[model samples]
Target: MKLIEALPIVLSCQNLSKSFRGRHKQETVVLADINLEIRKGSFVTILGQSGGGKSTLLKLLGGFLPPSSGNVLFNGQSLKNNTPDIGMIFQDHNLYPWMTVEQNVGFGFRIKGEKPGNYKHLVHEILDTVGLSHARKLYPHQLSGGMRQRVAIARSIVVKPTVLLLDEPFSALDVQLRRRLQEFLLALWSEMNTTMILVTHNVEEAILLGQKLVVVGSNPGRIVEEMTISDIQYRDRYHPDFLHVQRYLESVLEGNLKEQGDNYYEEVLAISRIQKINS
Candidate 1:
């Protein structure tokens, strides 16, 4: 096996299942039988339709939510709760509005009661890497949407976590900005080499970022498909292979929507047919 393939598993989940209790003691199964293994320094992307439990699965993996059954393993040990070794970035950027960019990025150290002198250099290095050094004095409200998200990413990585979970961090941005941030994130991942898992509904984004792509089916979410992506062609959005993979994943997502009895599925199919014909 190749050296990268021989890398140690940083995170894995075995027979993982999660359910929520609703009104009248009813149960809603959000995820089921999720078994996954993520190698160190690898990037994995979970792609599914909205409300398909992609985010829920991410939370379970990060120990932000408890699994109703099975276990999430971190380095072969069962993870019972959130750990500093695991970091998370959400869609909202979740920065302290009152704190400046530098303060927010270094807040992890402050909360742990560490002296600034101990972590100041680390904070500055990460800030400069993310190209946010100039905005270090700016508050969350003072930065643009993409800039704010970068700050959140910087904060999560400043502590040098072994794993990072991103819950659609760029979903809120416009197309151009989202693409820019995606490239920035890819570069950052290359530099930091953190084991990263991102959950998103966007097929293109998933294909663009992940070393492996996992598709979750809805209505009691389960892992329907997993693809190991290594070809450089998959990274180029305009490439034929990339478009082919994108279309296939879209069909998988549409099938899930159809299974849910979603009425918009037919409309989407019709639109897709029209677009193909026009092209």
Candidate 2:
């Protein structure tokens, strides 16, 4: 692992485990014996199959969900509950219907007893930064999907959260929009320097957005693979180096899912269409 110099470890988990009771006291484990560390200003992506406990792990790290065993530490302190220093963006933007763009973006500050006069400049600055200044007066219903998501990002980040946890924020958007938003997110990360951990099922998207990618396997979920891609050349989607990483991650996820069943063959077919196979 190529550790980023001068960056402090902002998040850490040790021997994490989460399970739930189902079917007459049958314990169904989601994640077990998991360990991970996220450094300040790092972009980490979590990839796995549908039932592979990807989002569950994110919740655990963020303290939105408690682990059945072990613990998660935020900046060397145990994370007991959701903290303002750690922000979260869900798949759904969840903007209030009546709230304007600026209102939604500054909502975090308002809830914390911060007057609008204090956060007014910051809200406008973030709105203009995300290219949503013109729509600041517009409500959630008035904005398009991409614009709404931008608002969501602005909302989570305006408060200057130490770390941001995103649960597949762009999964609902179409391909082109998703890429555009991905670029937008990268720009935000560059400017804000917030440590981000994103959970997604899209291998290509994961490869495009993350500095470090972690693959989680099902049946008592655990980290099966981890890769660090700091070289900018691999960011190009069409580059062989980029495709090689994508193919490798797809193969890992496919092999892990194949044991579950062949019913989920669409992923294999989609990957095969992009990658040539030796006959």
Per-residue alpha-carbon lDDT of model 2 for 1-279, expressed as tens digits?
223434789999999999989989999999999999888998889999998898889889989999999999999999999999999987676998989999999999999999999999999999998899999999999999889989999999999999999988998899999988898888888877799899999999898888778999999899987666666655799987678678768878887546544644455344433332210
What are the clashing pairs of model 2?
none
Task: Name the 10 consecutive residues with the lowest summed lDDT in model 2.
Answer: 270-279
Could you give me the TM-score of model 2 versus the true structure? 0.88
| Candidate whose lDDT is highest | 2
Q: Which stretches of candidate 1 lie over 4 Å from their true place?
A: 1-4, 256-279
Q: Candidate 1, residues 1-279: lDDT per residue as tens digits?
A: 112355689999999999999988999999989999888988889998888898888888888899999999998999999998999997666899999999999999998999999999999998998888899899988998889999999999999899999999998899998988899888888887688899998999998998778899999999987777656776899997678667767878777545634454455445434432432
Backbone clashes under 3 angstroms, per model: 0, 0
Model 1: residue 47 alpha-carbon error in angstroms: 0.3
Q: What are the models' TM-scores?
A: 0.88, 0.88
